[model samples]
Target: MIIDILAALFIVAGSFFMLVASLGVFRMPDLLTRMHATTKSGVLGAGLIMCGVMLFFVDSGVTLKALAVMAFTTLTSPIAAHAIGRAGYFIGVPLWDKTVKDELHGRYDEETHVLRSPEHMQDKQDQP
Candidate 1:
């Protein structure tokens, strides 16, 4: 009885987070922010849903599959979101007007397509 209740709770919570993620994608002002919202909430939602599934199922095979899916979702979601956001930025997607800072402003080289860190820039200056 307790297990069933817990599973139901997890599913409800996961569904809520997934709904929030969907809303975020539509409501966020820019590509990066949208990706950020979806990546975090979507991964959590998927994990939670998988957890619920694992709990509800009595079979070892279902548990293993759920675990594998959860692992894959957790690992890939953020990486894929980051790559997509980076590509969007590289293609000159504009940030929201209210954005306060652009840390990547001078760090990325268009010609070489390389992003240099503050430490790397300091080292280059010291070398010369």
Candidate 2:
């Protein structure tokens, strides 16, 4: 009985997070922010839902599959988000107008397609 209740709780929590993530993706002003919502909240929601499903399953095989799915989702979501964000930025996707500053402005050299910090921003700013 307690286990069932626990599983239900996990599912409910997962559902709530998934709903919030969905709303965030639609409401966020920019792609970067939407990525944050999908990567963070989406992962948590999926993991929690998987946990509940794993607990509810009596068969060992089903439980193992659920665990595997949860692990894969947790590990890949952030990496995928990062790749999308980097590609978007590299293709000259604009940030929100209210963005304060871009720390990556001079870091990426198109000639080499590499991002490296050269000591400090102040050092670069001090130069011509």
Candidate 3:
């Protein structure tokens, strides 16, 4: 009885987070904000679903697979979101104006001196 109750609660919580993620995907103003919502809510929702599945089906192989799925989601979702956000930034997608801190801006230029292509480097050498 207790397991059933716990499973129901987890399923409900997971569903709620999934709904929140969907709303955020539609409602967020920019790529970064949407990425944040996607990563956080996705991870949490998957975790809750896995927990509920484990509780509802104790000792089953399906539950083990769900656990693995949850683990993979936890590891990869944030990384995928970050990669997309970084790609968007590099491609010159403008961020929302309300964002206050842009710590990455201008920092990559200082860290790396090689901005142009090898062809440009060859041209520069040929000029001298």
Candidate 4:
């Protein structure tokens, strides 16, 4: 009876997280943040739900399959998220400007760093 109750609780909790993650994916301002929320919460929510189902069911084969599914999800979710984020960046998805400091900005000379003017060196030295 207690095991059943615990399993129910886990499933409910996992479902809630999954719903929240879906909401976040919809409501987040940018692709990167959405990916962050979806990837982390989706993986954890599915993992917990699978654990709950495994605990609640008595069939060994079903439990093993669920475990395998959970394992695969855990392994691939982050990779998928990373790929999406990289694609977004490559495709020029605008970042939340307030949240990021791009250190790479203006640091390089496209022609050649060695050919930079003395004024550029002076500007760098002037920065405290």
The C-alpha RMSD of each candidate to the native structure, in angstroms, is 1.6, 2.5, 6.5, 6.4
Worst 10 residues of 4 by lDDT: 107-116
Model 1: clashing residue pairs?
Answer: none
Q: Can you write out model 2's per-residue Cα lDDT over 20-68, one digit (the tens) per residue? A: 9999988988888889998889989998998898778768998999889
The sequence of per-residue lDDT tens digits that candidate 4 reaches over residues 1-128 is 99999999989989998998999888988898999999989998999999899989968997999899899999999999998986776556888776567433454464653334567877889999
Q: Output the number of the TM-score-best candidate.
A: 1
Top candidate on lDDT is 1
> Which 10 successive residues of model 3 have the least lDDT summed?
106-115
Q: Give Cα-based local distance difference scores for all models.
A: 0.93, 0.88, 0.86, 0.84
Q: Give the TM-score of candidate 3.
A: 0.81
Write the residue-wise lDDT of candidate 1 on 39-122 in tens digits.
999999998998899888868999999999999999999999999999998889999999999988888899999999999988
Better of 2 and 3 by TM-score: 2
Give lDDT: candidate 1, residue 120.
95
Q: After the best TM-score superposition of candidate 3, give how far the Cα of residue 107 lies from its true spot, in angstroms.
A: 3.1
Pairs that collide, model 3: none
lDDT of 1: 0.93
